[model samples]
Target: MKRQIVTLPLSLMRVTSIDWDIDWRGAPEAGLTDGNTQVVMNQVPRWVGHLDMTMRDDWLRSWRAHRWQAQGRVGIYRLYMFDPLGFNLQAIVGRAVAETGIPFATGERFSSGSGFSPNVYLEAAAAASAGDTYVTVTCTDADLVPAPGQIMSAGDWPMGVVSVEANGDDTYTLGIQMPLRADMAAGDLVSCMATGLFEVDDDLAGAAPYGKLNRSAFSVSFREVLNR
Candidate 1:
């Protein structure tokens, strides 16, 4: 897997909020161009994101020097936006081109700030044998058990968790959508997601801060390269 961990410009004191949009194009049925008669076909889904965070001067300086304005014109950079949430791409190209370069941002309030959807991960408490419908798992204080609707895998085979039953002591039985492809042993690795953000085709778009304040904030926008 080609991936890199990027620390935030600053450990965001607080993530005021994060917002994003997925756009689609609709073609009106052209027989008569009726306003209500349009087929809303989702085009290649493109994601645009915005983040608001409490910033630090050091981080702001770093952004200005490297990320926000690497060159006179903004340069492209890979952003691992959701590693904290485990939404990462398992495989990526080292030099995948981003779809767009950083565009300029107009900071309001001298304002700012910030920064994949991937398979999910579930912890294993106990192992299971072939033909067993339920599997046990040990949750790492930070880990969660496989939940219904998430596709999980042990070895190379993948199966969806259809149901989950909590049995106490951090142990849970996961009902897979399909029969096990092979027996899972205790301590086996299980996961439904790959790690890393979607590879981008172009450099990330850049935003420049308008004014300096004790606390900094700015917003950068970009499109993630799509991988299916």
Candidate 2:
């Protein structure tokens, strides 16, 4: 079923932590007579992980305004999750080293350059299945290829790049950190910094009661919800 995507604005809460559960399954440790474990599977092990986030806030105003659509445990939650490798777009090759006036700054103001931001993305050279770990990137900037270990978002699915290889025909292949969770059609866009769905725990719906007025401290957690 198609789920309503709930995008949270930054005014709601500031992100503190994104702890990914990367404890993937592997061959069983069957002890051998010589004190060694042995097991095997035909298919190469694929990486799978659960995404998590801890957002702290006490803003009753924002929560009350959007709780009907944002808070859930049984439904799918589409959120603009920031990856660890946040905002790795085009390299700011030639720019003045003026620091951004985030939080507080007394010096000069920062300037973001013009034109479309340099993005390392391409149409799928070939279709990929859900369990596939790689896709052929085609017709994009060679100078903007995804680096190894960088996260790339295919629509709402974000996966890391495990490997990169140039096919010599302007089509580069990207090996994903985790196996693809859904099928990709030819010409699908793949890039970094996107949204995905999640599931919150039933018992831990919102916050734990409250303290004094005008201020409260608590964390809201989210678990990645994958498609079947």
Candidate 3:
């Protein structure tokens, strides 16, 4: 069976600083061995990584108002060992920071393996060693859409649309909702023509720039298919 996953792409606004904390603790003993050997294991300092991001207000506002329904915010953020790496994880961390209404100053700490780290070093290392992993976040308004002529599929079924939007963000969100059936599955692929408007950075406007807004064809995978 096939399903769809809808997601929002989050731009890396900027990294204020990268930081970490190390903690040393003893491990629990398994049991007494046959011999009188009490195997004392070495206690190593565990390292936790953190990345503080100062996001632009425009980006945060656009994401909250249009994409996530105002789910997350900005603040000092930390990531553990097991969190999904890259844009997916960062988008979520951004949301959490936004939702808690926490100051952009205080940081939150989590265990290393709970799968919620946002540290760039760790993420890069993980990505380098293994093939890139895919992470999904709530759909955002500023997300880029798949362009026309882009091929999307639901399982093995190919899809087609009239147009598409290309915001250049990781995930594709529709500026206007499309006509879809109610029985869509969670992992189903959606291929359609997409078009939308986007706010470009001032710096990039001069080079290879089209307009304050441009229309284009795009393609995206659904993170979660919504039930009608």
Candidate 4:
């Protein structure tokens, strides 16, 4: 098999958080008739995060806007190293478009240890709760095993096993294995999410915030690949 590496710029990596619509109407409003209240059928924004990953240039170009299907396959791999506090890292495997640069089916296969901090986990969970589906995998520098945050138990906000099929003239099948949880099954739909925040610190003056804090800000990244 031919292999190529694609390095994604830190600006492209992102995490998106969607808000759950508790009520059919947008929000609680007084003096508004039931019919007049606008019902939002979709979720809204809650929080967002940005991340960075390096991959093959060819892979990045091929998956920029194309679509592909994916599925979960069983395999043994080592946990990659990540520095969530140091630098952002993650991994995923699935079928992607050859031309459109869109990923049809995708999910997290592994995550690095440093990538699985409490803040990172919470951010990922929030992304799932909103409506976005997709898991971020962080691979070791050697790419041998599951990285740091490999979910060993169920409670990892696991979505269902996702199967993606391309649309239009595209014909491809992709499967993604995700952390199994109580709220998810084998046929639920989900999207990949990334979130980022900026912080300012006096200790690291003139030092880049790639792994350190510099300012206080949050950003969200979102992409809908497949659902059910």
Which number leads on lDDT?
A: 2
Q: Name the runs in model 3 displaced over 4 angstroms.
A: 1-6, 17-51, 70-228
List where candidate 2 sits over 4 angstroms from the true fold: 1-5, 9-13, 21-34, 38-60, 63-67, 84-86, 89-121, 168-170, 205-218
Residue lDDT tens for model 1, 122-225: 55667777667777766643335455665556653445567878777766777863456568878787764312122223354434444546566655554433
Residue pairs that clash (backbone atoms under 3 angstroms), model 2: 153-191
Alpha-carbon lDDT, every model:
0.46, 0.55, 0.27, 0.25
* Tens digit per residue, CA lDDT, model 4, 1-228: 211212232222322332211122245453556556544442422111122333234333322411111101111111111223322333332212111223224533212201121112211111222233343222222322222232221231223324533323322222333322224333333222222211112222211122233222233222211111
The predicted structure with the larger TM-score, 1 or 3, is 1
> By TM-score, is 1 or 2 better?
2
Candidate 1 stretches greater than 4 Å from native:
1-14, 24-37, 68-76, 82-143, 146-206, 210-214
TM for every model, in the order presented, reads: 0.40, 0.61, 0.19, 0.20
lDDT of 1 at 204: 42
lDDT of 1 at 50: 60
Whole-model lDDT, candidate 4? 0.25
TM-score of 3: 0.19
What's the best-to-worst order under TM-score? Answer: 2, 1, 4, 3
| Off by more than 4 A, model 4 | 1-59, 65-227
Best by TM-score: 2
Q: Write the per-residue lDDT of candidate 3 for residues 63-135, one digit (tens) a residue.
A: 3333232122211111121222212333534655422323323354322111221222101001111111121
- Of 2 and 4, the candidate ahead on TM-score is 2
